[model samples]
Target chain A: MIKVQQPEPYDPLSQVPLVPPPGHYSASKLERVLRKGLFAVTAELNPPDSADPRDVLKAAEPLVEVADAINATDASGANCHMSSMAICSLLSRAGQGSVFQISCRDRNRIAIQGDVLGVAALGVGNVLCLSGDGVGVGDQPGAKAVFDFDAISLLRTLKTMRNEGVFLSGRKLTTPPNIFLGAAANPCIQPLEWRAERLAKKVTAGADFIQTNYIFDVDVFEKFMETLRKEGLHKKVFILAGVGPLASAKAARWMRTNVPGIHIPDRVVDRLEKADNPGEEGKKLCIELVRQMRQIEGVAGVHIMAYRREHMVNEIIEASGVLADRQ
Target chain B: MYAVRLFCTRHARAFESVYKGLEKVFLSLHPLLKGIGYNRLERPVAMIEQMSKGFLFDCKMCGQCVLSSAGMSCPMNCPKNIRNGPCGGVRDGGFCEVRPEMRCVWVEAWNGAKTMQNGLERIRVVQPPVNRELKGSSSWLRIIREKGAMKEASKRQLDPAKSELAQAFAKARKLEPAAVPLAKEPVAALAEQAVKEQTSVHSTQETTSQ
Candidate 1:
């Protein structure tokens, strides 16, 4: 019998250092923000549909100081907006803190490591690695999806790059990115316990922090936090629970039904439906969620995904009192 | 899609436990089976299973069946053949990189992970690259052998009883079985040959009811 060997496990992060080394690179500002014991607030910058850089600034204008740092989304919802790196480069230069998001859907490891260095050079302090929403969910469902590394594996690879000061090829880097690694979680996704266990895995993979999907269902989000706390992962990583405003009852219902990993309880929808001004009521509900999420023990901060409603983000953040605890 | 129901998924926790139980049962039989002569039926049965599954699910026979984990479609059907997730090359409207006409399998997997109760947890586990060793062989026997090896390794090495059993297995693996004659070509050609052989065999399997 010809004994054919089983394929060796193809771990991209194998042979890399298991733990981070001290003084490897400069630390990111968001890391300081979370470590300070002050509640941190992060908001996403909805890139303008046009190439105008001013549009990016204008979108970011309302979020300045109001948010500790703004996440520049990378082709979120599998739709093209201005590139997250481009906007983040501009934002970082403008002296506003930007958390650059790197989606594995777009690049291989070589390009991803290059982009990580590029963003660090641009003064972007933090990066959120995401296994982005499928292309079918976007305007162009015909695009090829390139998920080179899912969220967890990307975190591991990036951590190796920063700590080891070497590429995946074993070649040394003159300078590693002085950056904080982040990953995404969706607490409301089905098989609720799996979500928390995956969070523990990301933590094991060397994720310094996490930002979750929208928190319409804080009950579920709380349960997810409870699981993390039980696993002792809450101490190992910072979790910024996701919160977003609903434009109306219709928008809430649409998001609940169409979006993956988003759960909107019927009571919230009915509350929006019964309100005289559902738009304002939606913001109120979102504000309430932030307040509620802040009270959760493991939640270190909040990530506000306002979508197209970036202008109202400041009000939501202030009303939620996420920054009120800040020094 | 129908193949998915008949094989994996749709069973949830029931499927995982049954799969583990099958491995345990197979491992327990290894010592007894080592004494018997090589059975010719095993190879033919495995070949038929592979061919039928390949035909039905467009199976790459990744040897690791993620069909239930990835809806009914084969993730290997993706042009890039990424096991863990999708790439950005997925065209707008869920098009594939290599074949633009079809939906990307990983994209379908993401959608499935969200909707399917049985498949939801499988999405988070990172799958390894394709095992070439499993390509031409029966995954059933391979799974059994792999489980037996794992069981042996996990046992305390100081146990003299286990050492004797280990020696027996090593001896059994070293022994020569009667040789079967076939073309010494590559796997692709052998697979093609098997298909032809199967077709001829089935051709005579016509209706006797009439």
Candidate 2:
């Protein structure tokens, strides 16, 4: 079994870097597991809407043990919450590794580049670059959408800082951030033939790995993987298939209608409706997806996004048994 | 206007050829434009450009126009103003998540690119962020100036043994001794080179590890 370590003592003001083992891009355990050719699992932490540090700790306590790394989202859905940097700071202070997500919808290049150095100093090793949801989808519709950089440009900028030791403006840095860069993809979206090409663009822009939007249709997802294989992208980066548990058929239907990129097949919702207890059935479906994803040729792991259902992640991972063979 | 914009993308090749012809006209008129003073003509030229391109492509005049590279569809019209490519939130049926009534700009760009001579390849370029300072300016004039500068540089390179006045003027301006070749390189070629460099870096790391 993979061993869980106790939190080490840390000073919040320190800017010292965590030294990775030789040949690794980061000190992240997720990178270590993936590099060692073992199935890795990552989970998203629902940022609490409160200022209390205890709330952040409570939400992350369960995930720290099960997830290879915890992801702190940056104002996902354009709804304001505890800032992702604060959540990652709390996790890092507690000696836990976290993925610091940066969305380009709210910050310009200057603000974002500064935050990268801040997170890196605080011991964050993985960074997820996203274009973020448009501000119109949020509680506040009047906010400005400052997409100074899209996901591809964001990835490219971060990669330049890490490797070339310079910012986008060619300014030299005293010490560059050591990061494992990642980008988001939606494989089940429209104009299906062009999805893989878009992913290829992201890869060329400096994405070391990819986490897709929620996948409820294995058939369509398999087709996406086939395209990646044909382009030989699978050899260049790790691909993590995103899966989530539904609360009920009504909730699934609502998501399919309201959420921007989510695609829930009609049969899956019908099966959830036919079940005696839809909540329990949703967990079963998620576990089944994990098993099936593990068998896919190019899939490196599964990213579970159990929003508001964080408690079920432990049970879902245990039941899926992806880490059963690890020691 | 929307239908007309769609028509322009459908006939992107025709528009491209038209732009090439217009570029030649602008090039030939450079001496006259300089004589008239570009600063004095800026407002009138900008007004004319806005009147025409606005009617045709609903152009926002971001001033660094990439209409030819983007399949003749204006990227500034995207709700997010994403210049690189489509955001992940494009809805089913290829509609905009933010503006469901309208189709995704990148999707139209892709379709328009398919009919062009090199549209598919050109569309793959990762565009840099828009320069907010260039808003409401005339991209046509800017393109003409850039092309004129390129031509002047090439002429100087070929006839280095020819003009002392032009050479002295270039020295006074503190320009680079030679213009960067990147100004004339295809963006897609640079993107491919970046991918190759990344793969070579990975292979070198593997060799050292072994």
Candidate 3:
């Protein structure tokens, strides 16, 4: 890992660390918002391919006002980019809360365990554990795939570090990390009946929240939430539905065919195809989904992944009016 | 191998009972195995394990066998090697995201588990990461040795004498197993070779199935 020194001296007034409220896991704004029973929104930051700090700030410019916390992806889609840890640190320095995403595709247990402490010390508030894409899916297929820990074990390791104050090997730590833990879910995938059970396993392994894959079929997602509600898992962990703009009918079809685990419904594509401006129609669809999802019994919030349509996020959020009542 | 693997999963209930019976046999053979020397028996035991498990499940010999817990499916065959539940990348038809032609191992495991008695309970256990050190070693030998030692210790505890046999057993428990080098190649190299061999074998099976 490349060590980038903190560029400037600390300005305490810019971002004062909040003390965790009673029974709160971390001092994350997102956690506080969720616990308050208010809808929370998290947006993914487009990781810059270069070392410039301005690129990070520029990408975060639109999302800083609307999102409760920004997510820094770790080489999502198995493609190389600036590391999530560095982006988190930069975001933290800029007084914005960031979720540092860690994938088990590249790093072993030793590296991940050490990173838990590193991100915590940097004032990052949340860690999202993911079983990342395979190396074969990436540009660099020759790279060794080191899945030393799957998402469940990764969640377990972090839980051990935070709650037990020890490493996976049982070595003691002076100060355990104080951060919220999250795991990803795909409610639209195969073996739909087992999806809720899998989430149960994740919650048992110490997930504080869950963010799911893109949801185009609300009926299927509703069924998934119904299962979770029946098991009473919704009360255990917060769930944020993944929603995103489709750019155009062509883009929606492309994603349906190429992206794994993402099931874009035929009606959605037909809706996009009928619109004169599919890009605007896509944003409208996202905003509509956000409004609809908030009315669901167990949905805590929406995770809007705009991808290249990042510029449209603020518009979508504002139009959705999900956060209208909040200051 | 693919057909056999699927067949085993479909009959996972019967295989579970068979596996339980074999475990008993292996435990009972511990005395003879110990006399012949476990260190010397590693090669022969590992060879037999590879031939049997390899043909059945295309096993990668991860050494820390969780086949029973995984619904008789070998998780090491997963492209990302996820041991818990299925990843978020299973294709629409329950195929693997990495290897599009192959079924997702966890999907098969879930189906297989549905056929077993205690399948749901067993599959829910969160498995720890693979101990890379245990790769290429014989999981059968490891399980047999561990269970046999445990049984002997319990028997000693039940004895009224509470004599030298108990004390000797207590002393032996703390000692590490003898360091027997099972592979001439580095473990990482061996792992890579195993993966390559699996891919080739799978390709051949794919062709034959077609």
Candidate 4:
């Protein structure tokens, strides 16, 4: 029989806690992970277009201390980019927390299994499993997809390795990984009901945490939470809302109107239109959105997706009252 | 010739008596043999049997019954026995592990069901867990026989004429030839020789083409 332990009530409006739920991992161990995050924050770091790690490492320097972990994009939307694994290794060597974003596309089950073991061996524990963007949208349009497993299957595979010490093939691991498994969610894409249902599936598949798509509306997010509560999955996993600071109003509008899955509410667009400088206005809007997300009941954290504005992550976190030291 | 004639005369009378008795039994079993509905001899029985097997029943795995939900037949035939889901091993168009022409029965079923109006809603009902004790064991057969007996007991009150088609098919199978007599060795020898000649001629033509 599994023992259930109750966690201490957390205030998301204050300093965000990085602790795993009670009975999931030991409370002491969760405390250790949280202690590591006393001043740490995470920034999504996309890899450079060229093969060299010099430029990538240079780009990641300011984010190293301000952000706890530097998330490396595996293949952001199928475009040709430097390998995430190599960049992660470089970032880790440079004393940055390397959170590797591993996608299911372009890899078969065998390769995926191998990469998981390989990443664990390399001491990169944080992994985000995604059913990546289609090859048609990537730089290599002619390339074929090898969706040997979906995101849920990959999550299940990882959980099996960690908990049962067994691979998907039922082979025993020599040493089981203590990896923190994460997954992605698009709450803004489909009907609120379907989105909730899909999110429930992801949780059931054993996602330790979730990183959502860009947040443009807090009401839609709250509605999503309502549905999640109805489905009885509110307490199961940690949710990190994705927020990106727009470089300009044009970029914000493009993301809202042109992007397939992102929905930017009209109120946000109206606020951006009235501001003196759109970039500054967009940043302020992002900071406000982050502040609002922090007030949410079950949100564990916020994943700031600053697009090309990676440096502003620290400022936004500080302005939102998530980082107390700055205030 | 004289011996053959004597033997035929001696057995003819006995053979006629046996044939007459069998014909009487067959004619008594099915009155429908004389009518227009005669072609449906075994079809109705087969359909009833299939339905009794619970082939169209919803799967027990809930939250996402992708198979019954999708419209594909179950993947219980696959060794892994994945329900409401397909394994990573499925290839293009979601074919099964063993056969290519036969699409992943579950995927095909789901696709077919999804296109139909109100079809997806039918899958929302709960399916009971598979009674594992009734699978791959002798007890299953015993239970089936017991149930069949109970059915027979209840069915006895119905008119015998109502089940005439099933009775006729059973009688007809018994009357049909069980096995054809083997022709003499000369025919087998001729067929084997013909196959060898054809292979040799094909090989020669291929060599010439090369």
Candidate 5:
């Protein structure tokens, strides 16, 4: 029988019950990662559209052994798919670490609160609070977008829930989610300048760690890190620069044009366009970004955002050489 | 009732400029269009607005036009019609989780707002849900008649305790007036400070226990 602690004094790490509850994941690998001083690698795991647990495990198989934690994206882009919560439950049940994504795009306050309790109950550890993708860009344009709390607010909310052991409504929780809180940053995104300051804001809102948007422009990412360093924001949080393998030069160019925050330099596109094997070149570039990001001062880790094609994750990381001391 | 408070940012300044420019043209043409009052061009105007906006920003003509607030992207085009920021479904490279082929509209809005110089205002404002009655209306006239600012343009009163929109409004109200627009970052700093204090206290307690 699991005993719930009373005379409740909330400690963020008191998440693990004193005794093992039947079968459960060991610990939050992502949490044990010492910020700034240590290097870690996490991968984005896109949950399957089906309810099958094997499908979830199969998708996670590649990175599970390598990544410190695999992010289970919630209904990203407001498109329907498997829920991030389910993926977290399944992954933890399978003894894998997960960063359960909680988006403000769909759930209201009540739902968000319930999910926090639910994840905690399931023994899930890490959570990435996102402002969520706009519903206007999703498959269901007709559905109402719930910005119950934007990323910043969600971070604050989760922090309060854990520390105060109370809901945003001032209601107490029998057991608070002892999560290692994380928030996202889009360093490369425009107005081209406010990105770093925004990251600082995420850290300010109680994000212990940050996972950024794709880092296509090394110069832009470097500048954002510089801003964080200048502000001493680097001392406040662990920043993991986001990196992904681009498909081709054409895709890179298309992304620069049609995509909002992504900015691919002309030279990279030209490099891809000129390459006999653009796909292979893209992987090489991905490796290069990882190595370069590691050299940056503020970046403590890397979050590999490999959408749909997660199979190549190990190969890409191996090529990047970021797995030197990863557990 | 959803109270969509619009905090004016640099993008909103551009919106004001466009509104004035359109008003000048519309006022000059109102005499001409109204001269043929029986055959008003409302339908044609709506169609034109719909077509041009659809092509440019996929405008949904949600009578309370948030184009400027959303960096000229039509909030209606989003599956959830979220105005404040993005959802978790913001896939890699800003792809829409719902429509992998498409780019997330909020992502575009963030870029647009940034490019347009609404730096401090990004993700700070919370847009209220669309009023179905205002569908297919001219944003030009709506701006002139009701909300001088989108913040004032909200049509309903919200209960903060009961709804998310109300809670958002309460939070936004606590920030400095939108004129400063520098309000959001400091508030974020305060929240961060609180967390820091709590963690330090927790560590001290753990040490004492040991």
Candidate 6:
């Protein structure tokens, strides 16, 4: 009988300290942003179709001073919105810390490379690469998708541009951008054990930070953190729990009925329904959730996503006592 | 007499299979040639061996790893590895550099990753540069294909019939005879038949019976 010898598991981390090829840029900005730990806060600002960046800029301003950076949504919710890069540029010009959301849905490698270069030129240092929402969910039903590269590929491309100082085509860049790279996660939706594995993959793929989907239950977030700690990934990367103000009763109901990935608990629903004013009640509930999440060890920070109720961001942050030390 | 030695350092399995198949046919036709008369055949065999080794080095550009990780096709074999390129000559889906059956590595990788569970979401995260170190090390091929003498053993036997027979024998050895109750086996068979009959009757009643 022949004895089978099991090979060692492939450890990507074992190749740490492998320097990128000469002439490529380093993702220093991403490293710096994660290390600074100045209680980073970012808000989502969707772009408008028209070249006019009025609404986005206005939406971004109030939170600009308080937030370390503002995250502009790229055709958020699968709608035919304006380019996130353009809006991010406008926000950066307005002196707001801008994090540009680059989705893989609209562009191929050429466009992604070009856009990354363009954004860096504009001095927008933060970038989040997302495999954009499916075209089916967008207003433009028949719009074609041009997924030339996935998120990991985009990350690899960016890493190449930064470290190798060249695009995927091997063309050298004149001036590489100092960009902070981030990715998203949904801990509540997936099986508890798999979340850490997925997060580890993202980290291996070079994601500096993770912005999670809206977190309604702190217990689930705690479980996620426990899993990360158990897997020894808790200390490796920064994770910002997503919290959003539920807005009106209709909005709460809409989120429950419409949002596919988000999990809004029945307890939250019952609280919203029982309150005389659903908006205020929802806001209060969100504040408590954030406060509980903030207390969890290994939590880097919280990203308060107020959905359309952007104004309540200040309230949620204040109520959570996150602003207590800063003020 | 000049002696020629043929060596296949890589992809030894497939190459050995072809060599053994040809050897079998040759021996069948000329049994007397096996003794020492085939020393002259070594030169042509060595040339064929070299050609096969060179051919194995040509990248197939399957992009399995690329698709699983990046959502982009592999550009390892493509001259440009253009994320969005036809180069004006990519006909149907195959690149001009490779076979028609092989689609553009990048396109196929993107499609495969997109279909995997949570693959689309993971695709959103930015990827690091392709470790061209993957090229320098012969490790990728080494990891996929069996190596050394084991690979030679695998190639020598093209069919799995003997292995199948051994597996069947092992299974038969593990099997234990069970005492069956007189009514149990017949009753179970009757129940199965009854269910099948019921299903047929239900299907017939639902259809027009034409």
| lDDT preference between candidates 2 and 5, better one | 2
Which runs of model 5 end up more than 4 angstroms from their true locations?
A1-27, A254-260, B1-210
**Interface RMSD score of candidate 6:** 18.2
**Chain B TM-score, candidates in order:** 0.53, 0.71, 0.72, 0.29, 0.53, 0.26
* iRMS of each prediction: 11.3, 9.1, 8.7, 15.9, 6.5, 18.2
TM-score, every prediction: 0.67, 0.86, 0.86, 0.59, 0.63, 0.59
Query: Taking the tens digit of each residue's C-alpha lDDT, what string does model 3 give over A143-195?
Result: 99999899997898788788878776666799788889999999988878688
Cα lDDT for residue A83, model 5? 92
* CAPRI quality band, candidate 1: incorrect
Task: Give the per-residue lDDT digits (tens) of candidate 4, residues B95-125.
Answer: 5433445454444434444454433452222
Q: How many steric clashes between backbone atoms does each model show?
A: 23, 0, 0, 8, 24, 15
Per-model DockQ: 0.06, 0.25, 0.30, 0.02, 0.08, 0.05
The lDDT per prediction is 0.65, 0.80, 0.81, 0.54, 0.65, 0.53
What TM value does model 5 have?
0.63
* Candidate 6 accuracy as lDDT: 0.53
Which of candidates 3 and 6 reaches a greater DockQ? 3
Candidates arranged by lDDT, highest first: 3, 2, 1, 5, 4, 6
Alpha carbon RMSD to native, model 6: 22.9
Q: A-chain TM-score per prediction?
A: 0.90, 0.97, 0.94, 0.85, 0.89, 0.86
State which candidate, 4 or 6, has the greater DockQ.
Answer: 6
Model 5: which docking level applies?
incorrect
